[model samples]
Target: MSKPLRVVVWSTGWIGSIAVEAVHRRPDMELVGVWVHSAEKVGHDVGEIVGIGTVGVVATSDADALIALRPDCVVYAASGPERDTAAVPDYVRLLEAGINVVTTTSTRLVYPPTFTAQWRDALETAAKAGGTSLYASGIFPGFGSDQLALVLSTQSSTIQKIEATEVSLNDHYPVADVMMDGMGFGRPLDFAPWLSRPGTIEASWAGPIHLVAEGLGAVVEEVRGSLERALADRDIEVAFGMIPAGTVGAVCTRAVGVVDGREAIVIKHIIRMARDVAPDWLGSECDATYRVDIDGDPDIHCTMTMGEMQGHAAGRGAMVATAMRVLNAVPYVVDAPAGLLSSLDLPLTLPRFALRTAHR
Candidate 1:
């Protein structure tokens, strides 16, 4: 049989830890090395750092050392609230070292065409230099944004509008930066979250909106976004931390793709620090869902919800799904032509050999 694709996982944070586990479960992939940002995680067995039993691989903070291994692919699962600013250099270095990258960090990279000349050229230059490729994906900008909308468009004969929404119950998601710093949940009403900044939503989500519009042979002339915050009247519990009374407990964000002065493609996110924070936004029960509503000749509404898997944490299926989506694309990214790639550019990703055995 062909040698297992040599792989390294680049972090052990929220998604990074899970990515390590998913990569470990793959018989077709070898977990060769792990790179870490935290000094505490350095030298720990990757299996142990990720809560999996020891598999004999240690984590290293030295990027050069891990890159020196020349693994076939690196799952760049590190957090990048700043997107290109934080992760681009790391990606460039890995690509220049002939290491392919699959990242969940940057939503902008999910659609390469949305990038400016400099960022696009920078990655392309490094990728071509070492004959490697980089693919960015996750649950939101990754699949729920472009893939779900485009895939559901198949059933439509006449297209009018496409709306993609993600309703996440973050009571179990404990990432502070993501929940508080990036998304602004659990913050005060006057506190400006990253999601509230100008052009933030457009920059982060327009890729998928434009990607969906592109795939459907339509154009989005003007992209627009909106945000609404829900405050907690009383103190509440959350995985990240306590939601202090009278703080922002929920947020509903919308990015619209305007075509011919009408909303054509739209992406919305309803994020709750607790289960009932935003009851009118979507469902009331605590769960994660990616739903696409298409208004066309034959209207269609499709929603994908996640349930616990064998190895992943209970009520954290969506996070696991996010990691697996990028991790499962390792083989495809390795085989793809050298450059930045989007979902539209790659072949269908399958969970190869993932269905066979339960977690050992």
Candidate 2:
């Protein structure tokens, strides 16, 4: 307790860079090492790479070398194509080396029991062998759906249904693959989105559905995914590209949890390249908003948005929100018992010494 917690950050992507700046300013945490995926980033100071003034900790691509340092925890922020499925081994490797890991990469690990039996066994076994913990969390499946929904249920006398819906205005979102390919925006109506694929939604979002049900003492018999795409009424230009008239401009997708042969939990998203594209779809006051709706004897609605000035949203700040959700949990995760952890197991994560001057 006399020394600051030793911390390492993995990857230098959007999520990782924000983590570097946050950890550097925290008085109770010491920036130890940074792991980068790109070869060009090797040997550069992490603070410089993240655009903060240099803080002396240089970046490296050597995974084994960082493990040798045996930091208290690693903020595994690596994200790319299929990271949720591909990054399990990376996390297990760190756990086996006796290093605690808190990541925003894997959605299945949000509730460790929700993943396949093989992955579940592997993570549990690794954590047991090394006596460390692994916690996965982020905005959607992590907070808005699972944790936030459960907290709101405390007020209701009777709970019948829980749903987390995001009506996001993503015209300002510039990620090409996510905008065009993942959501099917600017594509033909017949174009198949990855979400439309069978089991894809369940694989990505079922953790939160199961977690919500488990938290409420219910059972989920099935999870279903559905999609609806609206065509652009006129020529629409987005941050990534254009959506011509009669082309896809909006998508409304839902992953529903059927419990006791009834719709109990749902994760719905109405994503738009232009707000007016889906006139009748769910709309928000800001550019992006997450609304938790609990239908029961006394209905409860909770709305959440970040970095909204007036009605516009800070698209870049969204990444920072995701990064901090895990970063703030480091103290609890490091001290917790060795195993896979979810929001259910963690105590209130306080941002200790964050208001004081930087200890760097």
Candidate 3:
């Protein structure tokens, strides 16, 4: 029988914590190490940090320790709303050291072909040098933008344009920094959110747009981005904190790809702290929905709605779904060719395990 793959869980944030739990539970994977960024998390059992009890694996902040352990794969879940410049070098170091990586961070790394020449060349070179691979995926850019679009395009006879939309309620999400600093939620309307900064949305979302274009046998000439926000009419309280009246309550953003001076591919986000905040914008038929519309000869449209799973909080369910998307890709990525990859390059990653049932 083949041995379990050795894995290191990097970070313990929203997705990272879930990664630790997933790795611990997988029979085909072994939890060998945990690397953390927070000083307070140092020297604690990873199982305890992720609320899975003690698994006897201590979390460390030392990169050298991780290198010494020689893990086969690292689940990179570190979050950086401002695009921490150091993350690229960190991945470069890990790849050069011969460790494969599957991450939910760095959306630009999701589709290597769309990335800048310097960044793409560096990562590809590192992977070739180490004979390992790197894969980046998540709920939106990973599944909604690239995977979903491709799946829906099978019905299109002559595709003219495609738009992928994500409408999610952020009230249940517990990340304060993501809601406040990154999204500008609860801030005054005039304040620019992190995503609204120049070139931020384009850099982060264009990869997926290009991936869709490539899948449809077309090329996106230019990708443009735009953002708009709505102010709250009354104070509202959510999981993280309270939002005062007149603050930003909802945001709608889009990254549109132009082919031949016409919009051919688009990614749209409609995020609201409260369901009532953005009445004019698109609302999900369910609690949260990922909708992909293909405007073409056949005109295909598909939607995915995720609600409470086994009575857990809605936001927590979303987080787990995102983690699963990354986790299920592990085996396929390990066996794939050594290079930076996109969803299009991999086979369908289906979950091998089933949910526990009450029946004995």
Top model by lDDT, which number?
2
Worst 10 residues of 1 by lDDT: 307-316
Cα displacement (angstroms), candidate 2, residue 335, comes to 1.1
Can you give the lDDT of residue 272 in candidate 2? Answer: 81
Question: Could you give candidate 3's per-residue lDDT for residues 1-360 as a string of tens digits?
Answer: 379889998899889998888888777788999999889999999889888899999999999899889998888888765453667787888899999988888777778887778887899999999888999988887787778889878877898889999988878777788888888899997787787899878877889988888888887888899988998899989887988889989988899999989999999989988778879998864456789998899988888887652323456656777787878888888888999988988988886553533211
The best-first sequence of candidates by TM-score reads 2, 1, 3
**TM per model?**
0.93, 0.94, 0.92
lDDT of 1 by residue, 288-329 (tens): 778888888898988787664222333567777889889989
Residue 152 lDDT, candidate 2, scale 0-100? 90
Clashing pairs in 2: none
TM-score of candidate 2 against the unseen true structure: 0.94
The digit string of per-residue lDDT tens for model 2 on 1-360 reads: 568899999998888999999998887899899999899999999988989888999999999999999999999999777775767887789999999999998867888888888888898999999999999998776787688888899898887788898777778777778777887888898888776788887777888998888888898999998888999989997788788899898898889999889998999878888778888888765646788999996899888875564446545556777888899999999999999999888986777776776356
Residue 322 in model 2: lDDT = 82
For each candidate in the order shown, give its overall lDDT on alpha carbons. 0.83, 0.86, 0.84
